[model samples]
Target: GTDMGTARALRRNLEAGADSFPQDVVELMGYFQPAGDGQRIRAVPGEGEQVPIWILGSSLYGAQLAAMLGLPYAFASHFAPAELDHALEIYRSRFQPSKQLDKPYVMLGLNVFAAPSDAEARLLFTSLQQAFVNLRTGRPGRLPPPVEGYERDLDPMAKTMLGRALSCAVVGAPETVGQGIEAFVQRTGADELMVTAQIFDHAARVRSFEILADVHKSLSEAA
Candidate 1:
């Protein structure tokens, strides 16, 4: 959540040589100052790397900054989708061209819990539901094991919060997941998707991703 000027200064430092350090970097003046011999201090490994910078946000602030800076924007829709649509709208509408990019680019976060069966996939998703509720209620701890009927036990407030926060999630078997993913992409028109899963079992987690990958491949082929 760095301010625009500070983020710009950091980017300049990373892309500039010691002699080319920005003189207007007030926030990090001392650390980026010239040496006794006259050469300005530079980010050793960072300098001249030309690393790609993507602005990530769960609110409108990040979208505006990324638009102004012409950087790719990523929305944290997996956990905070309340502002996803509005933020993307702001980013695309207010975007400016810059050396790094010529047009606005967007990547949306999504939670995918896939399994061989719809019932199994829904069961796997219970861990994330429990975890989200626990963290919001200030009882945060290690990821809990999946409970058979976790959603049925959540208080109304917690249920509503989860429903809104995780609105971008897909949970099902391969065919069901494929349909869900296609619908999401078509509705959002996102340039890219960043998928995440929170299954408790290690093997189940791995399998979830594998199923998602297969679904992605099928989608690509059909496209």
Candidate 2:
């Protein structure tokens, strides 16, 4: 997510101040090739061991980099959906097959808040909407408890922005969530969907995922 310089600085700070840099930290980092300007690192993990490199992006810049590097691309559509299609198109068209992949593989990030009833799911989703609003308003904190009338309290601009940013979110009952998943997949042709369900209640979060699993299983069986 950051450049090599930032990663190096972070590692150094971790080791110097907190002693938190693990020995395998180098392998866990990702940076761009400096293009013959500086010392080039042959491999991150070193010793010729195969390491999977996935490019995570929220816009086209990341897509182009991943395509150039011939790595799988993951788009953060869960919060940045406006440029998703354009980024995917660029990545697929310019993809250079590497040893790891023969074709462009796209992973889409999404939010899923599934419940037995639409009303409950909508209530649960308020947590994420509120979080997003707080983030946009520069007051981000831990996922807060769901508040009644939270979405309604948001102004028109906030509502529109959240609607666009979280366009990939699927929040509803099992059937509605299933339909949303199918529609998103059809729209993006994503090879994988990485889901985040950010409900504050632990039991409800688990149940949400369980309901999603059941919905996906039923969809698969029907297909």
Candidate 3:
């Protein structure tokens, strides 16, 4: 997420040079609002190629801009679920359809972890969940080893939110996880799901995608 000048320059280069990239998709990070004079988003004058910019925000500001501009919006709900509902409501209610779309298109971030079994998935998730806890406690560290027990130690509220957040996540066994994710996609009506999975084992991380692909195939067959 660069400044407006950078964005404009990049677009210019892409337009002038090789046409390998798509200039229409300008994914903007809404968190980096300009600080002072000449720093505001006015840098992006909402013109030139009419770049389809999507305000990526974890709060309301992004939603407001998306609505005003009649553009799409993406929420970082995976890591920051606290403001999800409010952000979604603001974006939808204020949305004004543009020529590009008749309705607001919203996307949510999600953390996904897939494994052979529920027990194994939980074991693999320990490292990733611990990383989140570390971020919260300001003691960030590399993915740690899978601990023997964390589900039993976490508080009920924390556990509940984590479970809900991972409802379409950290699911185990291809069949079960596949069913869970299908249900999630159906219920959320999400056009796209951005997944961020954290696994301690590098090889295991690669395998997660393979498992996910298989699950997707299984679900499609069922449908």
Best by lDDT: 1
- The 10-residue segment of model 3 with minimum total lDDT is 22-31
Q: How well is each residue in 92-154 modelled by candidate 2, as lDDT tens digits?
A: 999989877889999999999999998899999999998998999999999989887888888
Model 3 quality (TM-score): 0.70
> Local distance difference test, per candidate?
0.84, 0.83, 0.69
| Residue ranges of candidate 2 with Cα displaced over 4 Å | 1-46
- The TM-score leader among the candidates is 1
Order of models, best TM-score first: 1, 2, 3
lDDT of 3 by residue, 132-180 (tens): 6666668998878778798789888767666655443545777667776
Task: List the RMSD of every prediction in angstroms.
Answer: 7.4, 7.4, 9.4
- List the candidates' TM-scores in order: 0.83, 0.80, 0.70
Screening candidate 2 with a backbone cut-off below 3 angstroms (N, C-alpha, C), the clashing residue pairs are none
Pitting candidate 1 against candidate 3, the one with the higher TM-score is: 1
**Pairs of residues at least 3 apart in sequence or in different chains that clash in candidate 3:** none
Worst 10 residues of 1 by lDDT: 21-30
Pick by TM-score: 1 or 2, better one: 1
Tell me model 1's lDDT, rounded to 2 decimals: 0.84
